[model samples]
Target chain A: MDRVPILKAGDVLLVSIQTDLEDRTVMALREDLAERIVRTGARGVVIDITAVEIVDSFIGQMLAGIAAMSQLLDARTVVVGMRPAVAITLVELGLSLGGVQTALDLETGLRLLGAGPLDGGPSEAQDRR
Target chain B: MTTQPGEQTHIVELLRSRRETALDRWTELAGAELRGRLSRGELRGELDDLLSLMLRALDGPDAEAAHDELTAALSEMSRRRARQAFTPTETAFGVFALKQVVYELVTESGSNRPRLTEELMAFSHTVDELGLLTFETYAATREQVISDQAEQLLELSTPVVKLWEGIVAVPLVGTLDSARTQVVMETLLQTLVDTGSLYAVIDITGVAAVDTEVAQHLMKTIKAARLMGAECVISGIRPQIAQTMVALGIEFGDIVSKASLADALEYLLARSGVRIVREEAG
Candidate 1:
């Protein structure tokens, strides 16, 4: 399935990470999706990784790379929905996504993407085709 | 406070045997340095005198060995130590004993002294790297090195050793470096050619990471297995690996990555009509 982790709102691709994102997979996803998000002219992008179980140095670097790439595409990026296990692993492995935006949940993630609160929630954004 | 006397005696006996070997090597090395030109003779007297003096020195201080030839061997060792920048410390005895070994080999008539010293030094280094300063330490290190060697052998061991024909399993674990990969492929290919195993399982469940290079190597291994009339099964792919494979777009044209070793075993057993007795769950 051609799944891009980023979603766009008025040119912003608000991405929701659905699986464990390591370096290779994340790079694959980013290369596949970054152009699409940029072309849409999204103001800011949000990445939701609540479902992820680990965030090693490789994944952290990918996020930072994606965030920088998104900004060059004229969109600020926010990473939201980080699981505690992922955070702990990231810290223990000495990793960080320096300068990447972060939020507690999709609501904040969506807000950081320059979209106001949805009438429903991320379920609504996910529900859209 | 309860100790098994059996275990203690076993250790003592092991040490005794090890000491005998070390002492042999030690004497042989030390004797090499004192070798002087012999004009076509057994030259047994010089060897006997040196061995007697060494044994006495080892047993306790013997007030002798004013022999000019023996002292020359000792000086040669000191020169080597000085060249290697080794100070004569307490540990120098170990070095001294070893140097004496090389010296003896070198001084022996009809012996290429330089080559013998090189061999002995390499052997000495191997012993040190094996983490045993003395032969007695070999009890544990030797066992460990043997297991490490066992692991190495598995990497080199052929998947196909035919009892009659048609049975093979290659269990892979740890890191798969190129050398190991080469060994594994050779073993598997040779086995497939020999036994003509109808079913071969290359179970990689024990492997933690399945990168693209490894995944490609697996493909090559599978292809080679097929050329020899063997069907290959790759077992033990966890969820993460499955996801990675999907992301990497690794097409399983023919090779099957099953769940576990047991699953692969069951699959093979079913094909071969070997019924497995299932133990009732607790």
Candidate 2:
């Protein structure tokens, strides 16, 4: 059971999954991510799954669960770098992970969390506000 | 057992002796039907090869082996003709013509009337079997061709074009069946990942109709795209399609859908912070 490493970058917690996750690993990740979110007082959490090629219903639920848990802790969760096939499988499995925010990559994920440049400066943020 | 060895030899000897006349007549009959689609020399060469194979099948001690070789030759010719777009009738005629030529030669010789008729019957049966073989091969080849074209059409119709740096569009232009929708979904999603495009526009203006199934497929595609951190906009909904969707109670549920692709692009560009300004000419 390899532990998934969670790296903290500024106010965002980045979790890049580099191996196939089992049931135990997913459970552990959920617990560990929840703990890290509160301890670091992170504003955002980014889960990079670009290297993950396979996923099942359990993993799908785990992602949604993680997002929901982070939101309660006052942190926005953005699942990033999802491979196209994995995303399609999750959709076909009826687990669209609707509650979770997604980005194309880590940088975009961070941007969605407002940790990256707003691109258009304060005017863009004010416009949205 | 239907064809006696003696009868077989007699028929084989008759064909061997008048091979020239039989070959010439066979080529003429088949070539006339083809209308120069195939060159005369090529037709003659193919007929010559088939005639020799038939003679060997009748005259040889290893009858089974020779028959296999003959059918193999017939199948090869049928397959080639099929690929060349020759009609089934034209292909079968290439084999049946030989039967006509052989019958003419047997009647012209005019020897052992009843016995010759029996031998000719056996020869005719063999030729009929070969003729039917050609039809079988021709149909198989035609089916192969049709399926290949269908697969190519599936691939050709589902092209994911990059509309902008951060945007891609899949212009679906056919009936959206499960198989085709699966293709479109996979292609669109893969393009989103490959190009890292955050915006996808599924322009269904060319789609023939919109039903519950098609609407479901479209929603599933948009949802999948969203799962990958990209937003999908359904564009090109004609007035009739819009009516059909509304009548069927198909709700897009917050997915941004615009009337035209230009509108979708405008909305996406604005969302992405791209400002398009038209300066007045001085």
Candidate 3:
């Protein structure tokens, strides 16, 4: 019955996964994210997973899937705030998220999306968004 | 007290009364073992202090009660000698030489002739215990020294430095092992987070050889850094290492590898949008 919240800031969709996601929850999030991207026409997505620990292969695959899906929807997905231990675990598990772009934190992720071709030079991009 | 409270008390009384003779004689014997490593005058002071402690332990109303203090004093003495770089045999000889001092005193005096054999036997056991304690302490101190040097070597092998803003570099030397790999990963990750660097360069120019296991460890480190949202660039690929990697069928995949540190830095700077230009001088 519980689901992650997706908020829109300008053309980007910010999804903050603050809880440990179950398999069902992950599926729900994937579907929910796709619907929101369609409804809002969001060009960028930043999924903040700083609070999530112990990312198993299932979760890693789900994240990679989300990034791929977002790409198809014309949205750039940047997963941010991955803890060091989780990264080491993922690497040891041999599940390097090859296609996904990552940023240090949410602010950096947002800056990356905005600085690239999606948004124009500073002031004008701000006004248009 | 009149019943003679064991061997320890009898030995203590003899040592206390014959203190100067025991010290002088022990000094002479121990000096022979020292081989001029320590001056006789300096050795005499150490022998004097140790003799007094032994005498006190023997003179105690409950000699066994002084057992702990005596062991502590002996252990400290052995540690000091070890730190002074004395050999194990040299240290043991220092304690063993006192046995000769006591033996002579016990044998030369004819008053205790009736109990001479038993007294000499007990005294020999006590001196043997002291020698054993010294050898144990010497071994422990030597092990401590070796482990400390190992820790220092581990630290010296891996050094992480901040190359530029949002860029840090680790120039690795020596062979890579699991232990050193753990240090490398922890330090590199911590540095990446501390500096908030977007890029990292791991230059393995100093690494002696490249094998599959070493390659796997390097990949793990790089992947861990990427999890922290920092890209890793490996530089310093010597010809031998390159050939080894090829012959071993090691595939780095998408991970960027450079021929040298300078080239790696150039690649990093170019990606970060930093330009470098040289001006012509007159």
lDDT of each: 0.55, 0.87, 0.83
Alpha carbon lDDT at B184, candidate 2:
93
What is the C-alpha lDDT profile of model 3 across B84-138, one tens digit per residue?
8898998999899887888787766545656667766676777788899999999
| Leading candidate by DockQ | 2
Residue pairs clashing in model 3 are none
Runs of candidate 1 with Cα error greater than 4 angstroms are: A1-129, B1-165, B266-282
Say which prediction, candidate 2 or candidate 3, comes out ahead on DockQ.
2
Best by TM-score: 2
How does model 1 score by TM-score? 0.33
- After TM-score superposition, what is the CA distance of residue A61 in candidate 2 from its true location, in Å? 1.0
**lDDT (10s digit) by residue, model 1, range B1-282:** 111222223222322344444456664443444334221122233334443443333232342433233344434434443343433342234334544444443444344434454445543453243222222232334456578887777645434433222557787877676667667776775555444345677877667888888886777666544423345788888789889988998777756767986787678666655566879999
Off by over 4 Å in 2: A117-129, B1-7, B39-41, B60-72, B113-118
Give, for candidate 1 chain B, the lowest lDDT window spanning 10 residues: B1-10
Question: Which 10 consecutive residues of model 3 chain B have the lowest summed lDDT?
Answer: B1-10
Best model per lDDT = 2
Question: Could you list the CA RMSD of all candidates, in the order they appear?
Answer: 21.5, 3.4, 4.0
| Residue range with the least summed lDDT across 10 consecutive positions in model 3 chain A | A120-129
All candidates: TM-score: 0.33, 0.90, 0.87
Cα misplacement distance, residue B163 of candidate 1 (Å): 11
For candidate 2, write residues A1-129 as lDDT tens digits.
Answer: 799999988888989999978989989999999999989999889999999999999999999999999999999999999887898899889998978999888777777777764352324332321
